[model samples]
Target: MNSASMHPSDTNVGMMLVISAPSGTGKSTLIRRLTTEFNAFTFSVSCTTRAPRPGEVDGREYHFLTREEFLRRREEKYFAEWAEVHGNLYGTPRQTTMDLLALGRDVIFDIDVQGARQIKSNMGQGCYVFVFPPSRDALEKRLTGRGTDSEETIIRRLAAARHEIADSQWFDHWVINDELDSAYQELRAIYLAEKTRPAYRASWQAALSRQWGVS
Candidate 1:
């Protein structure tokens, strides 16, 4: 819980982290835990063509967009990455994240595999983490329990989940969501580890050496 312990890297540069998981795998909940607990992290709100659900707020939950507007921006290269899921289009803007990273804020994206890949290709940076449900049965049950989607939609999501799970092999880290607290701890540890990587902190080390009058 100590911010200093979590972030020992006093570097001016920040990292971009992309978290991808199947719809029912609880990635969103895990992301909330990280953002709430970590002071150095910020969430990148994505644009989506999907209509807001109950209690969802515009810009806060997502930057709501019409299909035409989404496609227009996509064509203009405004999005660093974009993908369509369950007939809805979602995208992360390039300028938003770049500006944040330039300001030394770590940015986290809650996106699908497609968008994650595109972000890596475009930005050439980011750590990808994929969360998996304990089992297919557990995933299905979680989706059903939401009651936000119809049975048909739930079935579609389950089918998509199979492919998403397979894609986890490409991710930098895999966290299984068997339990909320356990999964969150695993994710937090991964973030801390990435932040402390030698490459990430090399410049900071040099600066400290200079301050201490080390040759």
Candidate 2:
């Protein structure tokens, strides 16, 4: 769709946002808040081979698949980005995310660092945001407090978190999840500011100028 025929708020040139963080960093919670506040944003439902936890619904939480099925899909290149995290496979569907952006809807991905990096490479134009824990102590407390994983799993996750933190330089923006409200505000500001950047808004601005007879 051309910008000339679309309203500023309803343009088809939407953005792809890839948000990455280690487990228990409140990345999911912050993303939930952002999507709720911004009606124009659509959360991309990822495909996973992991069994859903209690209170997790199909399609809403994830598209659960068996290992065999996931492997088959991976071979077919159905995923934009996929990675094994803590023994479970997670992936984002390539076509669906592109379809959303083509229809003027911002797509948000809450994925692992590996998957986020793959998406950035595949799309080459997404906003990469890395969420960090306020402190190592806080990360430990949060992971232990979740009460979902075994001690072994927690140790593995903490190790993974350290590796992910080391890759923070790959991200375009960073938000520290010290307090939920403050962290969310920082995330929201990054998104809003990105949308207003000259490179992103140039087409819309040109369309507006043309409409106003700017010569």
Candidate 3:
């Protein structure tokens, strides 16, 4: 789609977006699928201290950091949002995200509930969505089915999910991932719908004027 055809303020094609979820809710899977399908999105890279899982690349999966490295950067106020997940710290570097958005490219953030809220508040305006599992049981099964976490970890995640779900109402939109393909379709629809919101009309008009040479 051409810029002139969109809202004047509507930078829909190139905007930072936060996709949040509790653990094992398929946020990563969904993001992977999107990155495969869309060329405009750059998955916002997050820094973390956790060891990489099998087949996960360092720069692609996360910017794996040492405890000292994370702390040093943390003290420098470099992150837009940071949090500790099971003793490992993770964060989104602020400048990288802003740089991407300034270039009119979409930065996709895959983060937990806490960091998501911080990014939304700090970024001021951007697309924020909570990815919900079909059901609690499904979440539990997915987590364990991977066999990556211990039972204790699973329970802790479930407890955390209870709080996350409570906060979903606070976000702009929600996508219940009962089925993966359907959820992706819904997410795509939401993106298009956002472009048409009244707030975006001025931008669309400006773009059109520029295109048609209307003073």
Q: Which candidate, 2 or 3, has the higher TM-score? A: 2
lDDT of 3 by residue, 1-215 (tens): 47446634455336666788888888888888877777777867889999899999988989999989999998997788999868999888888888876666778888777887888777776788899999999999998999999999999999999999998888888999989999998887776676555443445656667777663
List runs of model 3 lying over 4 Å from the truth. Answer: 1-13, 48-76, 86-88, 195-206, 210-215
Off by over 4 Å in 1: 1-9, 45-73, 84-89, 202-215
Scored against the true structure, residue 78 in model 2 reaches a CA lDDT of 87
lDDT of 2: 0.86
Q: Write the per-residue lDDT of candidate 1 for residues 1-215, one digit (tens) a residue.
A: 33453345566667898999999899988999899998888877889999999999998989999999999999998898988878999888898998888777899988888778899888888889999999999999999998899999998899899888777787899999999999999999999888876556646556556566553
Per-model TM values vs. the true structure? 0.79, 0.80, 0.76
Worst-scoring 10-residue span by lDDT in model 3? 4-13
After superposition, the stretches of candidate 2 with alpha carbons farther than 4 Å from their true spots are 1-7, 48-73, 85-89, 198-215
TM-score between model 3 and native: 0.76
Relative to the true structure, how large is the alpha-carbon lDDT of every model?
A: 0.86, 0.86, 0.81
Error of 1 at 43 (Å): 2.4
